[model samples]
Target: MTATHRTYPLDESVDAVIIGTGAGGSPLLWRLAQAGLHVVALEAGRAWSDPSADFATDEVAQSKLYWLDERLSGGDQPTAFGANNSGIGVGGSTLHYGAYVPRADPRDLRLHSLQGVAVDWPLDYADLTRYYQEVETFLGVSGPSPYPWDPARSYPLPPIALNTAAHIMRRGCDTLGIKTSPAPIAALSQPYLATGSEHRHPCVHRGYCHQGCRNGAKASMDVTYLPAAVAAGAEIRPQSFVTGIERDPQGRITAVLYDRNGITERQRCNAVFLCAGAIETPRQLLLWQAADSTLPLNDAVGRNFMAHVSTQVWATFPQPTYLYRGFPSTLITEDLMRPDDADFAGGYLIQSYGILPIMWAEQVARSRPLLGQSLVDYLMQYPHVSGLGINGETLPNADNRVTLSSEKDARGLPKPHITLTLGENEERIHLHADPTLRAILTAAGGADLWISRRTAHTIGTCRMGTHAKNSVVGPYGRSWDIPNLYIADNSVFPTSLAANPALTIMALALRTADHFLQQR
Candidate 1:
């Protein structure tokens, strides 16, 4: 079914207002609404859950769901950063994400205290671990505890069955002495039970996880938190574009003012939650400060950003692997994700999964010739060819940040400008990934392998810190400058951990929601 298009007039008043509706805002909306707060969630994008039309395919042009459509961008920003990559739809970036929801390794939290690089998190893994479990229960994540490579935690559910490529990768790891494990995913490996809801069944391994889950098998925010928030009487206003936050002379947030398409509106609320992702959240704060003279913001609102530095390694197998038949990612290895003290550079998992035919073709076309008639010939002769990737952490650098570009959008707001260069520490970490990646590929019996430098996972523009002087949000995610305003998203991370960021983002939201509940 196509997404229903509707325009909702903005509400004038609400107890609390949350912005952005992806991993961060969606769960917070549910939690706050369930806590009996009169909440309103504003999403710049519309709701899209149909998998048939949105799945990764051969089409040259894609639906709005295929890419992030928010007005906030980095095209005209002062810095040379790429445009923010996230869905503008109701579920936010969760709509287009590959649902590999691995937990942030415990070592990732101690970056400052241990390695003396970035600032340390006010809270530790133990503090946020329970909330991680809470999100796992709500999302029905499937994976084994203690994926053989790193430290262990009890998964709420078991791991999904490994596909052929994963199995072969596992074999390669075994031969090479590198441990392997099932990739943690948000999709249901089998039927799972929620307290008051029916059991969600398993995925059929359709490799369409990115386009949106058709069978409701992938546990996206739309299927999990949005419904729960609506059930709890939370009002969600999609297509509502928030412009600036209103504050009184006393410095407390008075209301959230926004517009519906082109009409102006406002919502008076006791509190505000800025759940917009890294780029937009910081941009919004910067815009507010630029527009208003009275808001007391230090220089840290848009500083110290860090996006995971990632690279892909493609390999050609000797047999028919059909890597695209199952989930987008089904296996991962944490061998490289050690503490900064290890022999290797502190890195994260090596991920391998299938892509859509066209995307695969595009990749081949852009990188090398591996598709079309040559690809068909290669597949017929040696169908087991596969690909893998390395997503590693880059240390937080104040210079690597988000800024407002001089160029204006259609509405005249400055697009996000990004100036990012991998720090020396991050470059060292990437250098260590080459040999490890080669080992994994060689062990898997791949003949000729290729590697490229490109990462889609971006994070850490507005991190949480002990002191308000260096960070945008306090330990509890409340903005130090704005008493009634809080931020919950990947932006709150002090350091990008060695894992896929979705689960960690949800976990942070759950943890922040708990803090909010305690205050109530």
Candidate 2:
């Protein structure tokens, strides 16, 4: 069956109905469709638009992709490390991500077995290696497959040539007896394979990736997986917000009710896959539970929230580094990422590079005085500034979970009330990682280093486990109590990995898609 614009009645039924179209939903969309299973993916955000059609010209389009109101006030709350938020749109947060995708550390996969901290995943790194490779190939990843830095796999493409900032950082790491390599990125450096009839082009180094790459060089789901899924017969509905799930007495999902702005409609389906991400996914589950507590309820449905507690170390240099001339992240240091660290309890992966003067100036404007010559001098020498961000693992805490607030959005649904704070272990990870990052900056002739310890990479609300009592989803990411109800988002993560969650989320989605395909 070929995909066509679907009407509200949905004259035909689908084998699987996926909600959310970002990291987790994208790959699953393609897998289920390719497996010949009827799939319909619902996206709350609008489809990607040309730069001209975007409303707020600057960084607003990137940040507000998910239809977040410019007046939205709750996203900038304080956290265990720093300020963090999420984007909502047709591609979900992937449209706004930094495009730096690294595989989950093998050590990360064995966290439970090694430390006895969280419950062990029913699956491990080896089980997902093949799927990771498939995802890497699909995304056209570029980087070295060295022993210490990468776990092991042939990169689909060569790493991007290092810029001056990257070269300087690499030299500093070499001097410190630490390994620094080109971070595996999803951006096209040289060229990419032309899959199907789509013509993939190489990156032009516009440095405007987060603004929804106009050149189609970035491997966002919009350009990669979603298009593949569409070609394979997957129906995608944008701007459709799923408000409720209608389940039968047998605990199987029957229909998904949604609203487009204000009008309401429903569609019947055999299975429902919730990939709305950590905060929204758990919030939806909790909402469903509140509506009917007897529906295969798990106390852990909204528990065990976790993410990388990140901190940024900014510095002023003597010369212009052209930091924003290319991709924001091209280099990294894993020296401080380890299970056992004395100074910091949590592990951090240090990255160098990001945004430009206008953005950094805005950030500094919020603080550090915006008055006379001081601010003017700061803006004048902005190109000479460089920074290192510490992306580190965080411990899961039941208390640091997402809950529905008394307040509601425009749709009258409860707003996301996140009660999260950094755990002791996470604080330790940053403490250990920052100084090593600072040393690298110092060695590179950096001064006036400013350290910021906050992050927005949220994860692990509806985690997977062997037993229904312990987790919401099962080994294959299906809801343990309700076979038809599946979770394909970051909510399935038990522990935050040492690296970014986006790549691992895609791998999990691939695994889930394979599971569903095998069932057919």
Whose lDDT is greatest here? 2
lDDT of 1 by residue, 375-398 (tens): 666444334567777788877778
Quickly count the clashes in candidate 1: 11
Which 10-residue window in model 1 sums to the lowest lDDT? 75-84
Question: What lDDT would each prediction earn against the true structure?
Answer: 0.74, 0.75
Could you say which candidate leads in TM-score?
2
Q: TM-score for candidate 2, please give it.
A: 0.92
Residue-level error in angstroms, candidate 2, position 326: 0.3
Candidate 2 per-residue lDDT over residues 420-451, each given as its tens digit: 67766777777776787788888888898767
Q: Give residue 345's lDDT in candidate 1 (0 to 100).
A: 36
